[model samples]
Target: VVYYFQARGHGDYDSDFSDEESGEKSVQKTKSVKEDDLLRKPFQKAKQGSVVHRRFAAEEWDREEARKRRFHLISMDAYQRHKKFVNDYILYYGGKMEDFRRSGENDKTDLDVIRENHRFLWNEDDEADMNWYKRLAKKYYDKLFKEYCIADLSRYKENKFGFRWRHEKEVISGKGQFSCGNKHCDEKEGLKSWEVNFGYVEHGEKKNALVKLRVCPECSYKLNFHHR
Candidate 1:
């Protein structure tokens, strides 16, 4: 790589001067050329050096790309696990539990424990990140408790459609006519008739479809209504 800092002047007006004006212009041009060469000499002298040779440059680049892809995949997997762990933790502990904070029972500080676990978790792959997962769950629970007592269960992607809540004042039905629509729930008591809309494919063509349903209180509150 060679870099020339000073710009070179284009076009040389030689002393094929036809008259006085041309001769003066040629003299000025010659002077300018001489000055440029003098300024450039030091840089030219400094350019003498052996070529810089990098061993396995191509191999190193390939390895770097592979390392980046591996890191990305690992991070994505870790993040998905983290979210699931946090969700379960929030549901179970509700942020109100013993050992949520650093107690005197543990002799080491949080930082010290985490640093030690860096090595321990590597070997114990099964229970690698349980500690941090618990910690995060507790942290989120506290935040939810302080800000709003109710959880935004709707934001959770329990299904293709995020939760779309509907109150029961609208649906009309008779006794024993409605039942819980949720597959997970078994509410077969007094309920209002509801509907579920989804897409279906027929002969490779996509089409819309609707099904009559009866959602119970618990399932209605938790389960999603339709696809987003």
Candidate 2:
């Protein structure tokens, strides 16, 4: 016996049962016009410009969250290190770090100092100061990216977006006392290092970037070591 079920006024189909030659009852189901309409409701509500707006909003939110987290991780010791680096860079440019610091008494946190420098570089229209500010900004971001992004494999993988390392000829780029990239590694001493190239897609363009990282000789066999 076969049963044909008609959908109610809502336009959704109901389940039906059929008796087969094997003496077992078989069930069938179908979606109704109402169900199809409901499924398409979200797409219908999305207007032409809404997708781009939503994407921009999401990107802004991600950047804001990252900025907040980065600032939060800046401890007094880290901040001091950053300050010293900035001061040294300023001295190289024949400027007193104290002068820069004294330029803004209200800027208390590291974030404030960075923001002030960034603003000064862009809005103040000083060419020399602009170059110095660019160097300072690069160093500041590099240190933080190394500590928080590169060293933590999980975080690196998560925040890497679609960027990936392009394994070409392996070459050591710098000489320095550097710790292992693995956060869980027990090695505290400096080890040999290498700079690796990474590729990513941005704004419909392919771009290449490099990062210097060290790996523990003993821990090189680990899966995450390649990322370092």
- How well does candidate 2 match the true structure in TM-score terms? 0.25
Alpha carbon deviation, residue 104, candidate 1 (Å): 67
Off by over 4 Å in 1: 1-158, 161-178, 223-228
TM-score against truth, every candidate: 0.21, 0.25
Q: Judged by lDDT against the true structure, how good is candidate 1?
A: 0.47
The 10-residue segment of model 1 with minimum total lDDT is 144-153
> Highest lDDT among the candidates is held by which one?
2
Error of 1 at 225 (Å): 6.2
Steric collisions counted per model: 0, 0
lDDT of each: 0.47, 0.48
Residue 92, candidate 1: alpha-carbon lDDT: 87
> Could you give me the TM-score of model 1 versus the true structure?
0.21
Q: In model 2, what lDDT does residue 168 have?
A: 19
- Model 1 lDDT tens row, 43-146: 47655477545676777888999999778657777768666666679788786435344567758665565334322111234345567744543333333211
Tell me how candidate 2 scores on lDDT: 0.48
